[model samples]
Target: MGNALRFLYGGFFKPQSDEPDSLGPHGVTISTVGVSALAHDLSQFDITSQVPQGLSQHVVSSKKAQTKPPPKTPEDAAKLITQTLKNHEKADVEVHTGHLAFYGLPLPHTLVEVETSSTPAYQPQHWKFELHTLPVDAKAVADGDGITVYVDARHRTESANVPREVHESAIRRSKARAVKNYAEADALQKNIVDAGYRVINGPNNDDILVRKYRIRLRGIDAPESEMPFGKQAKEELVKLVQGKSLKVCIYDEDHYNRSVGDVYCNGTFVQEFMLKKGLAWHYVAHDQRPEFALWEKEARAARVGLWASSNPEKPWEWRKNRRNGV
Candidate 1:
């Protein structure tokens, strides 16, 4: 009985050691005198009755320790939800439903319905999607039909593809600014700009990193810079879009790799505006929209802008002639 008590005590409370124990073969070291005192103290208790209850309590406590604690804060809750979602395969629809139910969150009627509810539907077949650019600068308007614009990188689809070095440089730049190291920050910013990105001030005066895109206005051809009324066309475009955001419905990429898109600013269709003003041609060879033809005809009838000329040379024809050395 004393040996059994010693064994139980050693199993439960013995300090770990590398050396073999003198009193027992279980690596538990106890002097004879110490064992005598331990047995005498335990003699008062009903050992059989107490040991089972104590062992059961220890087992119960161990099981409780293994259970996960509930999240303590909103951020923690969000993280928990994200982790749970990541654990299941995306195709495990039934499992996801069960998880939502377990968490007492309302399940969506359908995944596709939920996804499409917030996103804009694509325009019928022709255009791919829309790009809402950041505010344009005066210098970015290269010509009447070409402009350079920046899109917020954070919101772009390819933002995740940013190089690790660029990200590191941005971080370093931020730290440099915080420490008032303007020179270092400027150098880092130059590197970011060289990589086709810019850190511009946001509406809240915070820095926003943006990716640059060169856009060619679709369905319109404006005169070359040296052509008659070309300066007026550029000025008109600059007046319309400078310092304003634009909605560009992208159709295709031109040979120059510029995004060919229809530009709209402040509820005005920019191409339509230019065509109606006779600042640009309808570019009928590339686009056959009847409204463009109608707008150009109205401008010609009114004798406004370049339409005031008895005969205006087409910009595309001019370009072709120039290229052919005509």
Candidate 2:
């Protein structure tokens, strides 16, 4: 009776399978169902206890998260964005606030040309897209801080028509500035546009003298009507000094028996004004007044009067060409 009770108990507890079971001394062969049964039976096992003994540290991500964008102009902001993106090549930095997108690179040099945004949002604003002019060196100089830009003597003296003395004066002033002589430099720079010398003509029949004097513009060759803008130039000179009494200081005389000197009106250089108006060009025959070149340059930039054309023939060249019929 005892033997029969043991046999019945073993049969009831044994796993049931069609194949006979084979067990190794150190391992157990488990069927898919048996493994599932074992796992279900071990639901209370501690999963944390199964990790390898030497590797259990928590991982911390190295990525930096961005929350706000620095304030800047759309152009500047784009620069910052480009730098920011390049810096985070291996990761992402999200800029969730005030991020504006714009097109074009607008720095490090002059933007000679540009086109405005055609997008519907910007159309109503009538934005100024064209930069037809800038504060050119011959006419204006921007300040260092750029807070208050000082206009150069461009209004009356274009680069192409600036006087030689004026350029020498500017060089002296620039030298002063180089040495940090701020006050002297400022004074010298201001004097560049001031009338350099005076002009005087032969005395009138009356001892009192017809006027202060008659003076000839020292360096430039005013255009004659035969040349481009020649008539306009003569007309311009007539308007500036014809009836007006001028302060003349004659330094020399030209081959034409005319006094060669700088003419001033109320202490303002009259030829300087003419050059600024592009009424004449820097003459190389009598004297190559490169200083006046800047005055001409400024006029060209402004495209005023004679400089309005892309290529206005110089008076000398025009005369030579006319003679040669080339």
Top-TM-score structure, candidate number = 1
TM-score of each: 0.58, 0.35
Candidate 1 per-residue C-alpha lDDT over 211-324 given as tens digits, one digit per residue, 9 for 90 to 100 = 788999988999989899899999999999999999888899999989998888887778878987889998898886644665676588789999999999989889889999
Backbone clashes (count) for model 2: 24
Q: Give RMSD to native, each candidate.
A: 29.9, 34.5
Clashing pairs in 1: none
Model 2's alpha-carbon lDDT is: 0.40
Please identify model 2 stretches exceeding 4 Å from their true place.
Answer: 1-215, 288-290
Off by over 4 Å in 1: 1-123, 156-158, 180-183
How does candidate 1 score on lDDT?
Answer: 0.66
Candidate 2 per-residue C-alpha lDDT over 1-326 given as tens digits, one digit per residue, 9 for 90 to 100: 12221221122112345654422111223233433332332232223323222111211123243322242222333344333322333233233111211111122112111111111111113322211111122111111100111112332323445477766666676568668998986676556434532111223521110111113466676776666777677666555444343444445655654445554544456556777788777665665433355456557768988788888877667778888998
